[model samples]
Target: MTFNFLSPVSDEVLAHNELLTPQALGKKLKIHSKAHGLPDLDNVKIAIIGVLENRNDINYMGSEVELDSIRKVFYNLFPGNWYTNVADLGDILKGDAVGDTYFALRTTITILLEKKIIPVILGGSQDLTYPNYRAYDSICPMVNVVSVDSNFDLGDSTLPIKNNSYLGKIILEQPYNLFNYSTIGYQTYFNSQEEIDLMEKLYFEAYRLGEVSKSISLVEPVMRDAHIVSVDLKAIKASEVSKEQKYSPNGLDGKEICAIARYAGISNKVSSFGVYEYQHSKDDHITAMLVAQIIWYFIEGVNCRVSENVLSDSVNYQKYNVLIDDDELIFYKSKKTGRWWIEIPFLPDVNNKLKKHTLLPCMHEDYLEATQGKIPERWYKAYKKNSF
Candidate 1:
């Protein structure tokens, strides 16, 4: 029934798809259209869905959100050397109410997850992430969320949900499935001192914009543990986007944002990805192209994914143990991918969310830091959170 809510791709975009070259991504995708109905999703590795509801935006006017511009640019781009099948499931038009739209998105995402299809969502507002998170209620017992935003978005949970404050509701609401939440590229000025304190108090990770800009690789491990990765387009700097999408003078640039997308795609745990806070403008080619490139890089990363069971397989990884302040920190490095992970010691007494997954993704630098008689902040935080 929720599939019925998804409208076919616009005739205008379909007409444009006909003009694309044989090697273009549009020519390879199983696109849903008025003439073809829904495409067979069998063997499809990724499914693209557009959500056209922006009523929950804090600065919402009467204008509606559109994705045809991005879709057109995306379709015009050539595909990478990939073996995975992809599908465009078309758009989910806004329902009579915002809740109705959320319900439709939640159901559709649930179905895609059941079919082992990763959904690359084009969203109207960042608040749509709330529904995407809810779709995991029946799929996984615990979830980790990595939000790419300038603010913590922990708006007053007591107030009505808005794009700026959706995370507050997610943290306080039912199901209690969210185990850990991390923010990348956050600007301190946009968040309150209380919110910053709460992030620390709750042991949630927050990486500043400057820190991430200097080294984009820092996000890989954070993304590696995330199940849902939600990106706010407003997190991008004004110069990198169109006039309507210009939200901040200082944020992630085009290159940095695309790199983050690729990192999210490379993560084996990240199943759903969403880029939100889209504003429609007369000429949004620049923003559309950037978004399309982000999607392209993500697919490229997915294609390059390497499966490594570092815990179960010892032959593929090198192990190191460091003694720091009476604590023994164990580290594992994959010989195949050169990726590192630190072990979180299991405590028999405390209730733990990470009972099965003890290896926390880390960097070689973290192992070096532990060798210097210092504890890695990430391992410490994870250790503390697990003990809670």
Candidate 2:
């Protein structure tokens, strides 16, 4: 069926589906683009699927109504033809069981992947990542995931499939080696000792709020190796949220959230991205605005990478050397003079092996540090004669 955000669904379809009529669905929202002009769906490399289902037993606020509101808010915030190519694959059919909902989402992602479209899923719960990742598994040999959340999401499966425990289920089912997963902005309150222990055992990299600001650089490298990104809204502090089921007095501010989104967009390896658990019912205009901005940043990042030829061979092979020291690891770019020079003041913390080694697509100094330098050390030297 023809999809138009500005127009309503056809009467026959609405009647058959018992869905909201165009008028009742609310006004058409528009968002302006800063760079790519209007979106061209035919040329769309990114496809966003909004999953409104909240079937889980979690304490999440809002429901299908909030999902509709979020759609409108996004329309208004990103008015124009910015994502002309980015089609809204539309909402998944509502389901009674969490498994049922996840099934529909999984099917949608599978179809999108077949079409070679980058899926941007507006989440129902963190569990959504399971299917999103599953879709990638069918096509990609390996899938890397980056989770921005306050909890480890590695809770025991005894708990019902709800918002908080889905990620854990995904980890249990998916191969750990296939995932270059990292959890960011986690809080001590949301995780249990057992859960934390489980994460450590799994070798899952985590960064607390205090470390997030310092570790912002870690995002790119984590994303560099990733095939998909799963962002949980709860990772942002409650202070930054307009409305939330477990709204905290504090969370990642808007700026930090957007920067992370941008980082995801710029990572050429990220074939799909999803954001979950944004409760629109309790959200004020400000929260809606922030959510819209986050989505916009994702769009911007995609456009930036696409245009910068990030995926192109010329840009893809550009190398950065990562060096590790006792205190911190540094990144250096090889100069034509055959000397290593510090392009940025910061160095990505990388594995000891990456020192004096070469990295692809140039490493983000911050991500190298955050991942603790998974890159080989031979590509990076701790002591260069020109060390800054």
Candidate 3:
């Protein structure tokens, strides 16, 4: 079992946990430690797993990746008024080979998915997202991925898998389960024009940093439709993280990133969440606290999730129809949550990947735009992807 590959939380962290206030999350969580083998996962809503593999990082030198700092901070902080049970499964130590580590992570995440427990992954490098995405292969037929990143990371699929190029592997690899991929807070200058053009050509979604920061709520719908939400810490601005952790001067702030994490947690479709690109440094306290708060807010959002009877009953939602450019567009709004969804027309001629997800999550603005005879870009992209 891949769980056997997992090492217990360090005695140091456990000792620190004992000193934390009773109200702290450390006291509330079912922790995996030397004393306790594995926590009973019954009714457990979330599982935290730390990955200690960063050799895949293109800039790798021979340094080790440690997650104890983040764990110490996260456990010391107080949780919100949450009823959902959380478990810290400790860390997945690096294996004999990078592929071995990926296998361990992939199997672990797959088991967690089968049990209907969300795996909140604290990862060393962003490439671990490939395994996270792979874990969904057996659980779901089609998957939507949302990345909170500054670059597309669609490097050469022809090359070996690395943090910057893992997306290409996900795209070209067998089974072709990726239905849609969306990126939030992407910096235009960081991405090559070819990659940007490829994103548009493939009908994938990419939101710029300024646009998302201007209105953080814009990510709600995008996140609502996502199955795997991967966040890269490098997407955060230099001012928000430690000196060694900063990869860009222009990126999302701490608040913006946390808000995005909350949105990801609130999404019913989002089953796996990961924050990657963590670098241990002498002054990592700020970054650790920020990451901890991000996790906390995610838990709070999950607890606050409102179950909206989206398409079951007509009485539960209000339906609207708009004619744009001689084509009829259908939209539905949940009366209970006031959330909107635009229907993706079924293409009988083509094998559709989104048949189960016919009602694509959207915003009120999308309906208003359609009413004005303008096709919302998201709707257009979905429609095009479905047609192909």
Please rank every candidate by TM-score, starting with the best: 1, 3, 2
Global lDDT scores for all candidate models: 0.93, 0.60, 0.92
lDDT-based ranking: 1, 3, 2
lDDT, model 1, position 381: 91
Residues 46-132, model 3: lDDT tens digits: 999999999999999998898899999999998888999999999999999999999999999999999999999998899999999
Candidate 1 local accuracy as lDDT? 0.93
Candidate 1 weakest ten by summed lDDT: 348-357
Weakest lDDT window of 10 consecutive positions for candidate 2? 24-33
Give per-residue lDDT, candidate 2, residue 60. Answer: 51
TM-score to true structure, per model: 0.98, 0.70, 0.98
Off by over 4 Å in 2: 1-41, 60-65, 78-84, 174-177, 243-246, 306-388
Candidate 3 residues lying further than 4 Å off, grouped into runs, are none
